[model samples]
Target: MRPPCDPSKFVAEIVKNVPPSGIRRFFDLVSGLEDVISLGVGEPDFITPWHIREMCIHSLEKGQTSYTSNYGLPELRDELSRTYYRRYGLDYDPASEILVTTGVSEAIDIALRAVVNPGDEVIVVQPAYVAYVPAVVLAGGKPVIVSTHRDDEFRLTAEVLKPAITSKTRAIVLNFPNNPTGAIMTREDLEDIADLVAEHDLLVISDEVYECLTYEGKHIPFSSLEGMKERTVMLNGFSKAYAMTGMRLGFAMAAPEIIRSMMMIHQYSMLCAPITAQIGALEALRNGNDEMERMVREYDRRRHFIVRGFNRIGLDCFTPKGAFYAFPYVGATGLSSSEFSERLLNEKRVVAIPGDVFGEAGEGFLRCAYAASMDDLKKAIDRMDEFVGGL
Candidate 1:
């Protein structure tokens, strides 16, 4: 005799509603296909620098394998405090104001859950990362999408953001050098948003994970603005800058009350980030900037290479100011983004994400992440030429 087969009780409605990450789904499909060239993933191609890897090894050797404090190891928190002020001009008391999470990815989730109540609204700017909407849904908040225009370089302007606010609005998620589009917000843009948040008294989740990868100008943390530090939870990590994605560590800085509140949720959801990874990230914060500079310089070179190649090949692409993606307008191809992407991959073996994955506004574009090798990028460009020529 077997127990009753009511496995549906084991599944959550929230998990069922969450679609697979659109970027990763394409990567998986193209994985075993012969002669595939992928520009689809958002991870850096660089290996974690040897010194950071050594520090993790040292931590493990010293029996630093125990679980850290829910908020994270204090020394690492202090290092993050120093690094935050030193790098971004944002000051936070690491002990009371920071909560380390698995990655900025989780930092986004927990912070949103802490702030948003059921039926509250969370404003998401597009074309944004794929995570924000689902996180908002799981937290029982409604997602109010604010479209950012390509003609305006896809920035989240104050003009674009203000009208979307209402009495039920709980928070706004800000990402820059943003994912998919690689557009960054300017200081003026931050000031306007800050003024809005101040007027409406809204919380902010500012994701600046690509702060170290900007090419056109400096990366400005929205939390660094005058009144925003109190209202904004700054989420960032070593993944993009140090090529330490697999290390699975990130930190959030906010008002002490907000941090304390989120910590309770973090304590339950995840005990703490991996002890070994925290050790490596702390070392990266203290000593890895030189390596970061080299990587940014290399990415800058690849940025120019991809943008120029796309322009020469008849794709209308704006120069990305931050992050390692090239969002090129593919409207002239006379195909929808899905059709174009599928045809390109199947015909030319070149992989890129259809921009609609970011949002409906992204329909006429394709996001080609340049975080692959220079040779791979060059090969992708060659394949693009061959594919477009056939059209």
Candidate 2:
């Protein structure tokens, strides 16, 4: 008989070093509880628009279940190209510059792999999505974190970003309308960073999945900046904007060279994004604009209400200009972010994620997503108010 294999010894050091997702733990804890009002997960509460769903269903009925080309359906790529041109004045070749992946998650993974070499340093703005640093590490790269402050509306400016650069730095992962903070970079703000990128000759992976959900000014695509198109790999999808998170459809746009590099990794691993999801996404681009607009308007209303409510209850929350989260400082309650989140879950049956999970800079805040319904948001606020009063 063969000896039993030792799993721990066989695991890669990089995989072992990465911590489990902080968001997932809270989600699992809340799953078994009763009457828990959760504002922890960043997913939209809205279902995928009915018309998009119907299109997907129709495609399935027509037996369009075969795998698409490794790059993706040409029709979907063409739609994406047109959409980018219409929205951002950025033109990409549908045949060579676009590659669809399972989701933005996969796109990030492939983009990192394509650009990062061993010992390469990737600058990650803190209070970022949980995946960025891990993806960099998995690609055999080092992550250099630059913390953004609430005083700056959590925007990453060139001054703050400059000090972190080194000879080893190869790329920067930019996520505007950022997760956990809902911070959006203005055109002027991005110009500063673009100057640095030009000076350093660094690649940029721009995650714009939340592009459509900005409540303030229009979102400026980083690739739209002068000279940035050649260096940027733009990643976006149907998840947040269309409430199609489960559909797992996302695409990357870059110069042909970068897209081809990313495609090699994707073809070996994922082969292609789901055809049904691709069909749905195509419909979303073609006809779901009004429904997408309606969802954004509703999210804006909830954003205002939640920010106002948090301030009224003595939790100092900065009003976010984009995305669906409110990052409120929880220090006034005399508890660390984790402590507050724990007590809120155990004592009040409300769920909110600790800010520090994103990075050390997130310590004093808790990320409260406003993607839930108005009723749930109100209930969560009331419970939180009572909890704060007792504290």
TM-scores for candidates 1 onward, in order: 0.97, 0.98
Q: Over the full model, what C-alpha lDDT does candidate 2 score relative to the true structure?
A: 0.94
In the range 266-327, model 1's lDDT, one tens digit per residue, is 99989899999999988998899899999999999999999999999999999999999999
Which candidate achieves the best TM-score against the true structure? Answer: 2
Candidate 1 residue 332 Cα shift, in angstroms, is 1.4
- Candidate-wise lDDT, in order: 0.91, 0.94
True lDDT of residue 347, candidate 1: 92
lDDT leader: 2
Predicted candidate 2 versus true structure: per-residue lDDT over 253-372, tens digit per residue: 999999999999999999999999999999999999999999999999999999999999999998999999999999877899999999999999999989999998898899999999
Candidate 2 vs. true structure, TM-score: 0.98
Q: Which residue runs does candidate 2 get wrong by more than 4 Å?
A: none
Name the lDDT value of residue 105 in candidate 2: 98
lDDT of 2 at 191: 96
Q: Supply candidate 1's per-residue lDDT for 193.
A: 83
